[model samples]
Target chain A: MVISPSKAAARIRAAAVDAFASAGYGGTTTRDIAARLDMSPAAMYPHYRSKEELLFAISFEGHTEALKVVEGADRPGEEPSVRLQELVSTFASWQAGHHSLARVVQYELTALTPEHYRTVVALRRSTTRVVREVVDAGVQSGDFTIPDAEGVTLALMSLCVDVCRWFPAGNYTNPEDIGKLYGDLALRMVGAA
Target chain B: MVISPSKAAARIRAAAVDAFASAGYGGTTTRDIAARLDMSPAAMYPHYRSKEELLFAISFEGHTEALKVVEGADRPGEEPSVRLQELVSTFASWQAGHHSLARVVQYELTALTPEHYRTVVALRRSTTRVVREVVDAGVQSGDFTIPDAEGVTLALMSLCVDVCRWFPAGNYTNPEDIGKLYGDLALRMVGAA
Candidate 1:
């Protein structure tokens, strides 16, 4: 059976994400990713210009998915409190569910090339903007008694993102449980009740 | 002026902590550490065994300091709410103030050898134990209303540790502001108000 270059590239990307997530971008090499895919490092060059390029691809793709996750939670004309809850629940759940990819996307920003780093940071700003907007809405509606909307927003985001750092998959409940727990906690943090 | 081996070792460790915090563990090299200290890589060997050894030292030291911070926050016979406020205020402030060191300690756990990793993990548990104890005390005293003590503790911690991840040294207010914000946020998280 012959594999097309696109199939090979997809396989390479999958392997690279896993390797980078596990060993970190600096610890992972093109050779290790190629070995995981049963391809030569030379073959990988056709798919990704360099290891950093593969990392940029993974980081870019991960942030794009996160943007989609948070955007999906935004319902037009929804109440502020409800919107904030949905946003935290969906976004935190995504972080926990796709933690391996999330780890690299969030933690390995330092490993990207300067231009790629700027691109990913810009995408991240969009996610941040969506979150801040919801929090601001909550504050304006008096549904959330937040002293500083920006600080509260940062706290909620940190709470959600840290799920990727320590959420144990097999030992505890699933990502939805975290979503609900953090959703409630976020409301509390924002003085919703 | 001749530098003693112990002094040189200390310099190397300091340099390693900063470099690892800035560049990450995998991205930093022994040569970079040695260069920062104006020592040869060969000269560095006489002090630390390897780059990983230096990383392990920084991590080990950081956790040790964190343990002290939390333990110091423990005041006998204090109310749980007060204890928790102090505990989080001090701990989170420490994280923000020494964020460079805290970053290496928290994020570079993956780079340590298994044996070194175990040591750091154990120290981290002590910090966790202290925080959980305070939350549990609050719950028992009816001073805090939390559905899941463990989960609430985790969220509170995630809020605090993340200060090191994004708190800019030259940014708004200071580490004390973050400590106070998180302390209040923690209270809100547990339904203390």
Candidate 2:
């Protein structure tokens, strides 16, 4: 019956994500999240004081996790084509594997408090920056041919970020397959030579 | 005050889109949408019996419009490369131009009734079919090369649909520019020769 403080907080967050994912941040109440965990609102109060705070927690964690994935995927000494393929495939599959949590993380930004929004936006920018750097390196090394790095980087990020929206649909049900497919497509998108 | 019934309904749908875009479908109430137009919920009931109905109306209209855009852009007689460029440019830019309404339409599908969801999804499939046909045409005509038409079509749709999420951000502000960028990227993705 007794759980550690961190474990309890993590449980509350997992429950809250499901609630918010199904009903949305605005539609979901702290009470609803509490009921999902079968905990009293008062018991849940110590971890997340308000709905917005729980959202911030989820947003912060998700963005941080995404940044780490992108960063870990990058191999600086590798050819730009290889780097981009790795980045896109890894990020896309991550988006798919954690789609429900990813959906809430991707879609509910406007619900975060301004300060929390900024923190999360910074994390997002960092993630984008990693892709941008690889894109720039590709252009510099002539491994990729593109009109502009900024625009190409934007499209690359958009493609990966959008996996959460329609993953496990049609024939693209498996995350690993998605990663492989996107890896090849990413190379093509950059005009890999 | 004397708006025609259709006009009144149109206005209501527009208001609901803004409300849903900001607060999400689960977060928004029909009363809130009515309040935005300074109309009582009683007056709004004739056009849309419930919030879900309003969402369905928006989804139906948005999907129908998107399908029309894709079909209109396809040039069956043209080279697949040219056809795809036109299709991607038009669809991406359209998604950008109508980003707010598009966001509501793209992200709020889970809020619709089962029948309504099916109806809207069919329209979506029609739109995707247009692009798939173009990709297949390109592959058959040797205008483009790809691993699979189905996967390419899915990526193409995802790239365009995601435009609403981050349009008008980081110098990619103009819808026309997005159109141009995506059109070029579509060619790259298909390995146009």
Task: Pick out the ten consecutive residues of candidate 2 chain A with the lowest summed lDDT.
Answer: A140-149
Per-residue alpha-carbon lDDT of candidate 2 for residues A1-193, written as tens digits (9 for 90 to 100): 8799999989999999999888888899999999998899999999989999999998899999999999999999888888899999999999999999999999999998899999999999999999999988988888889987889889989999999999888889999988998999989888899
Query: Candidate 1's residue-wise lDDT over A1-193, tens digit each?
Result: 9989888777888898888777777777899999998888987888898988988888898899999889989985998778888999999989999888888888888878899999998998899889899888877788889868777887888888878887763333589888888888888888884
- Counting clashing residue pairs in each candidate, in order, gives 0, 0
lDDT of 2 by residue, B77-97 (tens): 888889999999999999999
* Model 2 docking grade: high
True contacts kept of each: 0.50, 0.83
Chain A TM-score for each of the predictions: 0.94, 0.98
Which residues of candidate 1, in runs, are more than 4 Å off?
A: A2-6, A169-173, B2-5, B169-173
Indicate the worst ten consecutive residues by lDDT in candidate 1 chain B.
Answer: B164-173
Q: C-alpha displacement of B118 in model 2, angstroms?
A: 0.6
